[model samples]
Target: MPIDNNYTVKRIPPSDVDLYKELRLEGLKDTPEAFGASYRDESTNARSYYYTLLENHDVFGVYRNTDTLVGIAALALSPKEKLKHKGTLWGMYIKPEARGNELAKQLVLQIIKIAKETTEEILLTVVASNVSAITLYKKLGFIEYGTEPRALKIEDRYYDEVLMRLPLT
Candidate 1:
């Protein structure tokens, strides 16, 4: 998919494990409630583990003209036969400086384009309090089907998640 000239979006290959890890850590730290994994949990993981993720998951990144990775989104497809027609969009985040632009929309559109090739639908869960993110998802055709209460507990606070899906077929 073609993005703006100021930014380029592409999949993060295994060779770029370090870059992927760096971006992932930045996302986890910047928005702890946005992701399912904790910074502490991923911080201790080995380099090989990150490489494995790059190999197994369809992870995409947005890079500025200077070649700096500023955004990321990932798609994970289930292997089970019953769930093969569905995929999950996860770990989507863009740097604070890159937020005003439509980088996030482009990144997600790329994911949906790739997902439609094999999956009939895509699923995602965003923190209920993330109104902007929820609005973006809805703008991209995702509809909320349910809410998962206490989906995440960071320290003593619990965060609810709004479950959403976009049908590709």
Candidate 2:
């Protein structure tokens, strides 16, 4: 089913490593390739690897009925000091059954809150085919920054990626 205001959004803790791995793998396995990594790549990472992401920075998930993880969004620091003012926003997903409820907007709202508190701006790359995601980001004040042509090669075919940014000024 779908949850409205009753559902809550909370920061993911290291204890829920398995659940995090499961949902993230599901995102990677989505038919349109929702993420930069793949299921095969995740299959190689150690269990503790995912735990590190939840533990290292503040990544959160929006859950329904206190158990159903229907949506997720993350903001993590950049690896370079010069880019410290910038953060990467990614790992956004809403279960198929959870669509049409403005959940993605709420999730991004949470992410943007954190981004404002932690970084100057957020940068994200959405697969060009993901109209819904691009539209949501734009609605949240993201502007087109650039594009990556043929960014992904999946199944012998190439796909372009659109880079978008939200300046928290």
RMSD of 1: 1.0
TM-score of 1: 0.97
Off by over 4 Å in 2: 1-5
Each prediction's TM-score against the native?
Answer: 0.97, 0.92
Q: Which pairs of residues collide in model 2?
A: none
Which ranges in model 1 have alpha carbons more than 4 Å from their true place? none
- Write candidate 2's Cα lDDT for 1-169 as tens digits: 2235567778888887788888888878885456787788887899999899899977788788777676777887977889899998888878888878888887788888888887899999999999988998998899998899999888888889999999997
Question: For candidate 1, what is the lDDT?
Answer: 0.93
- Mark the 10 consecutive residues where model 1 has the least summed lDDT: 1-10
What's the lDDT for all of these models?
0.93, 0.83
Tens-digit lDDT track of model 1 for 1-169: 5476778999988988898899999989889999999999999999999999999889999988836888999999999999999999999999999997889999999999999998999999999999999999999999999999999999999999999999999
Tell me the RMSD of model 2 versus the true structure. Answer: 2.4
